[model samples]
Target: MKKRTPKPLVAKKLIQPIPEKVEPIQTEKIENVYPLNQMIEKIKTDIGHSPDVIIRELKIGSKRVFDAAAVFIDGLANKDVIQKVLQNLLVDVRETELCEQAEITDLIKNFSLATGELQVLSDTPIDFNQLYDAVMSGDTILLFDGSPVAFKIGSKGWESRGIEEPSSEQNVRGPKDGFTENIRTNTALIRRRIIDKNLVFEPIKIGKRSKTEMTITYIKDLANEKIVNEVRERLSKIEIDAILESGYVESMIQDETYSPFPTVYNTERPDAVVGGLYEGRIAILVDGTPFVLVVPALFIHFMQSSEDYYQRADISTLIRLLRVGTFLLSLLTPAAYIAVTTFHQEMLPTTLLISLTAQREGVPFPAFIEALFMEVTFEILREAGIRMPRAVGAAISIVGALVLGQAAVEAGLVSATMVIVVSLTAISSFVTPKFNLAISVRMVRFIFMGLAASFGLFGIIIGLLVLIAHLCSLRSFGVPYLLPFAPFVLKDQKDGIIRLSLWSMTTRPKLIGGQDNVREKTAKPSP
Candidate 1:
C-alpha cells in the first residue's frame, strides 16, 4: 500500500508542441516571349480560346523581322481602328521602304502607329492581365515578333443609347439631355453644364468581377475636403462582386441600414447632379445606369423637385407646399382612418360617423383589416402594372384598381369610405417629388397603420417620435440627414421647405458647401 501511494504521488506536466512558422507563398508571374506567335498562343490559352476574340496576324517592316498581330474583342473594339492599324503596318509600310539602318520599333512606332492615340508598352512587354483588361475595355493590342513590347491602341467604339430626356425626372424647364448609361457620355453632359476649371471628375473602378467604372464629380473649391475624402474612402472600401446599377452602390454606402428612408439621392437628370455639385455635394455616376447618386442628401432635398427652381419662386413655393402637404397625407390618411374608426369614433363629425358606420355595418373585417385589404390589393395591382408590358401597364393598373375597389365595396369586404381613403393615400404617395422618398413614405405608412390598429393615435405618435429619433441619429457621409430641421440651421432654411428667389439663396448649404459657401453675390435686380 505504501509503494502504490508513492507511485501515485507524482504530478503530470502538460506538454505543448512548438508552433510552426508559416512562409508566405509566392505566385508565379507569367511573362510574354519575344516572338509574336508565342504571345498569341498564350493569349488564346489565357482567354479560354474564346471565339469572340479576334486575332488578326500580319507582317511588318521591310525584312518582316516583326510578324505583328492585332488582338481585340469582336463586339467591343471598333473595327475601323483595327483595320486602320493593320493597313498602316501591312499596306502603308510596303509603299515606303523602311530605311536599311533604321530600327524597326522606332520606324513603326513613330511613323506607322502615329495616326491614333497609341501607348507602347516597351517596359518588359504588356502584362497579359493588363492585355485582357485592355481588350475587354474595347482597346486593341498590337504584339510584335522579336520585341518584348505591345501597343495598346484606342478603339473604344460600341453601340450605346443616345442622349435622351430623362423619363423619371421630367421638368417643365431645364436641359432636355439626361445622363446616358455610358460613363464618358455622362461626364461630358456634366462638363457641358459646369464649365468651371475647378470642376473635377475623378474616375474609379469598383466591383471585382464587373469592374464597373464610377466617376465622382464635384467642384474642387466649393466641395468640402472632408466630404470628398469620405466619399472616396467609402467607395474604396466597397468589395462587392458586381455593381449592376447605381442603386447597388447607394445601398452599400448608405449610413442607415434598417431605416426605410434613403440617405443617398439618385436622379437621371444631369441638371440635378450639377445642382448637387454646386451645393458642395459629391455626385457618383456609375456606368450602365442612368441614375447618378448624390451624397449628403437632406430630408428637405427629397421634398424638392428639379422643376422647383426653374419657375418663379412663388410658383415653386406653392408646388412644394402641396407636395409637403400630400406627403403627410399619404403617410397618415389610412392610419388616421384606422385609429378613428377603431378607437376614436367620437372624434369624427356626427353625420360622417353615421355614414361610415352604416357603410361598415355589414363588413366582416375590422377597420384596420379593411384598410389593409384595400392597400395590399392596390400594391399588387401597382406591381402588376409595372411588371406588365409598358404599352398596357398603365391601362391595366387603372382598370384593375377601379374594378377591384368597386367590387370590394359592393361585396361588403370593406367600407366605401375605407376604399376612398386607401385610393387617396395611393395617389398622394405619388405627389412626392423623389420616388425614393415616396417609397420610404409608402413603407412607413404600413408601420403607422399597424401602430394605429394596436394603440390608436398614441401608437402613431410613438412611431413618429421613433422615426424622427432614428433620422436624427443618421447621416450621409457625416452630414446630418435631417438638415436645417433637427439642428435647425437658419441660413439653410431659405432653400428648405420653400423656394426663395434665386438671388436670395446666395449661400450654399451651410454644412457641405465648404468655406466658399457664398455661391454668388446676392444682388437684387432693380426694376
Candidate 2:
C-alpha cells in the first residue's frame, strides 16, 4: 500500500484549545520572496565559486528576457542539456507557432524538446512556496515582467551514482541494485518490484522549511488504514527546516526516541523493502538517503536478513540461531566470566581455575579491572577499525585486536583468559544483521558487565530481569515491541525463532498494524 508518510504512530490524544485563525501557506508569493537574482547573488557570496543556480539573458522577438535557472545538487542539468535546450529555443521559435483553432494548447503540449515540454507558461499565479518546490526539483522558472504566473520548465539534469549493490547488504545471490540519494530512482526501483497497481507510493514534502520529498510506499489492501493515518499525522507534525537522512526521520518520528533500541527498522535492500511491503509494512524513502526505513518494527527484525529466506530454510534456521546465540554472548559472556571468577571460582574446573590464577599471578588489577580494561580497549579498536579506510579496515581490526590481546597478557595487565572472553564478546556482537540492534546489545552489555563486576551472578540476573522488563513493556508504532514472546502467540512462533518452511509460514506477524493476513496458498498437500 502507498502511504504519504511512514508507518503508523502510537495513538494518544491530548485535549487543547485551538488557536485563532492562522495565516495560510504562502505558496505563490513573489512579493515577500528573496528575488531569484538576489538569492543567486547571495548563494554566490555565501558558497565560494560554484552553486547549482544559473542565470541567462536571451533575445526573443527583439527583446531580451531575463530567466532564473536551477538544477539539483550535482543533478542532471549540465552544459549539454542547457546548450541543446537554449539553441533549440533560439532557432525553433518560428516552428512553435499556434494554429487559429489550436491556440495555446498545441504550443504548450508539443513544446517539449525532450520527453518533457518547454513552453511559455503565461497564466495563473505563483507563490514562494511553489517556487521553493520548483527550485529543489531543478526546474528553471521564467518570470516575465508584469505577469502574475511564472513558467516552471522541467529540465532537471545532473549526475548521480548508478544503483549498485548496497554496502550494508551484500547477498550471496539476488538483484544487486539498491536505492540511491535520488528519490525518483528509488521509487522506480520499488515500482519495478511490485507491478501490482495496489502498490502505492505517495510523495510528501516534509521539513516545514526545506520541503524535502519523503516517499511513503505501501500495498493499499495489505496495510492497515488506521496505521497509515497515524503515519501521515506524525509526518505532518514535523517542524524541522531540513532532513538530510533517514536517521533524521527516525529521531523525529520514532516511538521510543530516547531508547537505544530502534523502534523502526532500516535497510538498504530493495528486496527487503519489497518483502516488508508484501508483508504489509510501510517503506519510507527519503529524498537524499539510501537508508530506506521500514516499520512497524519488532525486536526480532534486527536479527534477520533477507538472505535467510533466500538461502535454504535449514541454513536460514541456523543463521537465526547464531544471531540469537550472539545476542546472548555479546550481552553476557564477559560479565559471566567476571562473575564466575570473582564469586564462584568453585564452578570452574579445578585445572582451569588454577591455570587462570597462575596467569594472573603478577597482575596488579583484579578480575573486574582486567575484564573492564580489555572490553574498553576492544571497543575502541572496533570503532577505529570501522572509521579506517575500507582497504585498511580488516588489517586494522585484526592487528589492533590481536596485538592488544597479546600485549595485555604479556604485560600482565590482563589475564589471557580475560582477553579471550572479551575477544569472544566482541566477535559475537558483529553477528546480527541490524547495526542499531547490535549497538543496543553492546550498550546493555556494559551495564551487565558493571553489575557482574560489582555483585557477581546475582547482579547479572537482576540486570537481565530489568532489561527483559523494559523490552517487554516497549512498543513499535503502537504494536508490542516484543510481541509473540510477551503476548505468547503460538501461531506467530513458527516464523519467529526458527524457519518454518515457506509452505507452512502462511501468515503475517500479528498486530504489526498490517492489513493483509495470508502469505501463501497450499501448493500440493500430501494426502
Candidate 3:
C-alpha cells in the first residue's frame, strides 16, 4: 500500500484587524474665511471652555474702530507681560490713523506693541493645530476682527523647580546645578557650559495627545554627522501617542532591545551631558523629565563618573580600578561560591572549606539554593526601600535586612556565609555609576547563578564567554558598545579604565570624535 499523504494543519481562527475610530484633526487644514465671532467660536469649540484658557475681548484704537481678542492658557502665559502688550497695543493704536489690516500690522510691528518678540501669523486664517500648540505652550495669541492674521506674543512663564544638585549623579568638585523638569532650563544648563557658536539645539515635538517637546543638542563640528542623523531619524520614527519622559524615547531608539545593557545613557547632571557632548555625543532633552539621554553610550561610560575627571589622575585611576574590581565581584561572587562548594571543593583551602562546611552543616538547602534565596531577598529589600516613603524607607530597609538575615540564619533556612556573600554582592552592585547598568548586572547575576549551579565553573566560563561576545556584538547608535577596549585603539586608552592627566589626553575617543580627534595639541603643562 502507498504511504498516506500528510494533511496540512489549518489555523483555528483568522487574524482580524484592530477596530479603531480616527477622527480628522481639525487643525490639519486651514480654516475657511470667517468673521471674528465665528473664529472665536471655532477656537472655543476646538479647545473646550477649560477655565485655564483665558480669552479676553477688548476694543482697539481710540475711536473703537476694531474689535480684538487675546487668547492664552491662564497659568502658562505671563499675565504681567500680556497686560503690558495689550496696554501698548490699545493705547498706541489711537496714535496711528491707519484702519487697513496691513497698516495696523505695520504700526504694530513698528511702534504699537512694546514686546520685542512680536510675530505675525499671516493674512489668512491659521490652522487650529498651530494656534492651539502656540497657546498651550505659553504664548499669547491676538486676533483682530478685520485682520486675517493673528499676532503671537512671546510670553512663556510658569512655575518650575529651580536648579538644584542632582540626587543621582552627585560630585564633590563638579557644578552643583542639575537638569530640571523644564526643557528650556535643562538646555540652559548645558548652554552655560558649552558657550560656542557650534552648539545647536534642534527642537522636535513628539506624542499626538501630549504634544511633548524634545530637543537634540550637539556640537556641529565636533559630533559625527552620522551619529547625529541616526539619533534624529530614530526619534522621528517613534509613532507612539505619548512620550512622558526620556525613558520612553530611550527604549524606542535602543540598538539592542533584548540585551540586558542600556545602549542610551541617561543622567540628571548637566556636566555629565556636556562632557559627553565634548566627546562627540548628542544629548536628548525631554520636557517634564529631569533625566536627559546621551546617545552612542559606551560600556565603560556606565563605570566612569564625571567626578573622575575632577579628581587627581592617580586617585581617579585607583578608584576606577576599585569600581571595576567590585563590578566583577558583584557579578561573579555568588556563582563562584556555588560552583566551588558544589563541584570544585578542592579548589578551596582546607581550613576555609572546613569552616564553610561547618556553617552549612545545619543549613537545610544546598549552596546554590541558599545563595539564590539570599540574593532575591536582598533585591526585595532594595525595591521596598526605593518604593517606600523617604521618611521611613531607610529605617525599614535596614531593619528588614537585619531581621530577615538574622532570622533566616537562626532558623537554619540559609547559612551565615551565604548571607555574608549575598551582602557583599549587594554592596558591590552599588559601586556601578549608572543605575541602568546596575539593574542589568542584577538581572545577569541570576543567569550566572543558574549556569554555575548546572555546570560548575565551566558553566560560568561559558557564560562569561557568551557575555563578552554579546557585549562585543552590541552597538550604541553605530558605535561599538565595548569600544576602545574591544577594538584596542592605543590613543583612546588615556581615558579608558584608567585615565591619564587631562593635559596628556589631547584627543577624544577615536571612534566617537570623527575627523577632528585632537582636542588640544599644545596645552600640555610641564615643569
**Every model's TM-score:** 0.92, 0.84, 0.93
Best by lDDT: 3
Worst 10 residues of 1 by lDDT: 6-15
What are the per-residue Cα lDDT tens digits for candidate 1 across 85-174?
A: 888887657424443445566677887775567887765534677788888989998876656567889998888999999988878887
Task: For residues 41-157, write the lDDT of model 3, one tens digit per residue.
Answer: 778877876888988987766543556789999889999999898888767676334543335556666777888787888744456677888899999998866456688999999
lDDT of 1 at 93: 70
What tens-digit string does per-residue lDDT give for candidate 2 at 1-527? 76443211111121122336434333333333333344344334433445555556443221222233332233545556566656654555342224223322233236524426454443333344455466457766544223333456666665677888999777787778898988889989888889998988888988766678898899998887777887888888988988989999988888976677889899989899998898778889998889999988889887888888887778889989989998899989989998998899999999998998898898999888888788788888888888999999889989988887898788878888887788788889888788888899888888888899899999999998888888987887777888778888888887787887788887887776355688767674578
Return the top candidate by TM-score.
3
Query: Which sequence of candidate numbers ranks them by TM-score, best first?
Result: 3, 1, 2
Ranking by lDDT: 3, 1, 2
Q: Of 1 and 2, which scores higher on TM-score?
A: 1
